[model samples]
Target: MWFSALSALWLAATAWAAVDRGEDGNIRSIALRTHTLKQPYLDSDMSSRWYDFGGDTVIRTDSYIRLSSDRPSQNGWLFSRVPLTATNWEIEVEFKISGKNQLYGDGFAMWLTKERGQLGPVFGHTNNFEGLGIFVDTYKNNRPGTVFPYVMAMVGDGKTPYNKDNDGKETEFAGCSARGIRNANIPTKLRLTYFQDKSLKLELQYKTEDEWLLCFETNEPPTIPSVTYLGFSAETGELSDNHDIISIDAKNLYTTAGSSTPSKKTPGRGGASKLAKQKEGGSWTWFFFKIIFFILAIGGGYVGWTAYRTNQKRSHRF
Candidate 1:
């Protein structure tokens, strides 16, 4: 049994090693786009690779492409200049949303559509698109029982309106509420994987410090036509936030392993601050607090008992 396990591991490792990863460690991708979003003339320098549409969208040197802010009625989109040519592709992006308004909203979106810069109702873009729309909905447009910061996906056939009142429950192919994503101490990571006609998977790390949580996966045939562009859009209505995309890494999967299944580290791992994990979920600090609280409670009881005993002894002496 041990020999068989070792052999299996060896075989998998060998197969992985056989694939060619170029000098940049990018495997089999025909086109790779990586941007830190930190140049003075970013819009110009990236004009050939990216385009910004709508209002109040700015590229900041501090490390993000700002889509929209707390400003009401603000809407914008940043799109890829070139189409996603690869049949199987993966895109990883680090993003965060923070601003005033405790009841923040209209959220953000990531798109793989046949068209670009078309704005309408679906998170600042036109509805009925002919591709995939991944919504990182921050506010509760509807659905009272559901939590905020819901992440959902919809395949557009260029017709159906995303039922926002139901929180897209009607149109949503798959979705889940991802708490701790907005204003996370560390940027949340969003990874999307589409393997041709096989499957589409979405993973979200509420906090950069945590492991990727598989939000949802669907095997339904994508209603989207050939994806021509990739981009992000955001809007603000009564509520708002600073929707920012820190960085994006897009890669073609077909080149790396022809018709191969998705790998364990499909989008690769992230290096985030350890302290950030505490903000999202319980950590060593939680245990430490429990221990300290227990000790303090015991000490308080002991002190009270000692004082009471002393008072009784004094009264007896009297």
Candidate 2:
């Protein structure tokens, strides 16, 4: 009986060790197909890869994708169709936030998660969600002396609620408050890197010097499940900003199966895996709206030109 018990314990330890470390003492490296989000409406192919939610969100000027409007109580979300199937990967994003004036409330969140479009009080997506969330909070929800425009990260286990009242201090795994993330001369950049061995690192380019500031690194196992979605969400209470996502680059850092870790294979035939297939709605309305918006914009430009010409002629006569 003692021998049997000892064998069981040994088996459990071996399993834990396997899950806790990378293959061959290091995570395998891989190359992933890049998905770029820019201009002329999200392509139908990209529509197949990305999901947009909320009324105020839109793609504008054939390039920038606006995630939210500068309106109170408004919220918006965009999720990638691709799932981070591999254990080790990196996602980099270039984004900008601007508004007519200074006041901005709530903030924006970038997520690598098991949940999609689940809206709630925390940054437009649900709290207690499974996976990791990196938030660029633009408003100060805490006391008078606290910093504004904070960047923070939280890892969830699908059961713990984020402490929204205290600005996530209670639930934050790691974070930093960056003052100039919004309205910068150059777009703000963030990179998230995760390894199978459980090191999660974040780098930020909040200034124009082209340097990456290390926010924080943690050794905790990314409690998120194997299959997860990549998404962004934003919310506004009394204040708001025009949150624009310029680009997103997701790269798989580990090699496909047949390496030392043959058990963990890339999803599907490609290095990137599609978000678990979900029913998508028609895009005719979106198509028509884009057409009308462009038409009106052109007409408005013509009218302004004609008016300016008339004024110039009158001035010459005088």
Candidate 3:
């Protein structure tokens, strides 16, 4: 009996240790190809959605989403309903600059936010550009001295705007150079990773069939809450510019604990809430299992030592 209990404890510890650290957190993704968008509608995969501020938009190739900013006040937004909580996650997409003009305003961005559903060029105009936005800037209006083809991760609430010209303290997260990914011609892949422990990393890469070249990396971390919806948007003012999204993939890194176990709660209108509760319960179960295993290991070790001592005593008497 003791041996069996010890073996079970050892197996339990091993199983817990073998749990994949980088599991995709059971995140579900949506593809943008199946859904069609009207001119003013948002483009979305089944998992996430997008919205445009009124303009001529069309689905060109089955995989590519296109927008035309003929109207001066045109803007586009693709947002997800997921709330921003403190968790680890990642968002990646492919973007290309289709057409260009003199004042193309701001091109587009990958946003993780909790802003009230008003979408437009939140970077140049207002203080509500809060949360985080990875901006691909075509127009150098914000940074007059700099040339085109730049990327930046904008953080902080939409209440403060980062001044591109000033070095210190105009905005929260400032712009960075993405000279490698900007081709004005070809497409490039952008990826952002957020750790629940307040660590954020950004990577811009050029993708080819055989390999991916990493363009830019940042030492700074993302300054947003844990759980937030991941999405994209674009805006244009005077100078006409259009940004196209080829694809998007997002994964939630934080999984609720004990998700595998069944719950006793009566399922009702609060299905989502109940599901969340079950996840929390699963986490507790995992924790409890770990504690039990530890206790068993200690007890088994003591018993084994006692048996060894008893055997030694018998041999000495003989």
| Top-lDDT candidate index | 1
Q: In angstroms, how far off is 6's CA in candidate 1?
A: 32
The RMSD (Cα, Å) of candidate 2 is 25.2
Clashes of 2: 10
lDDT, residue 181, candidate 1: 87
lDDT of 2 at 161: 91
Q: Give all candidate RMSDs, comma-separated.
A: 19.4, 25.2, 14.5
Q: What is the lDDT of residue 97 in candidate 3?
A: 62
**Model 1 clashing residue pairs (backbone):** 28-255, 120-125, 120-126
Could you give me the TM-score of model 2 versus the true structure?
0.67
Global lDDT of model 3:
0.56
Lowest-lDDT window of 10 residues in candidate 3?
Answer: 31-40
**Which parts of model 2 have CA positions greater than 4 angstroms off?**
1-31, 34-36, 44-55, 143-146, 255-318
Instruction: Tell me the TM-score of each prediction against the true structure.
Output: 0.69, 0.67, 0.55
The sequence of per-residue lDDT tens digits that candidate 2 reaches over residues 94-193 is 8888898767777889998899877778888887899889999887766356677888888898889988778887787888878888888876899888
Clashes of 3: 23
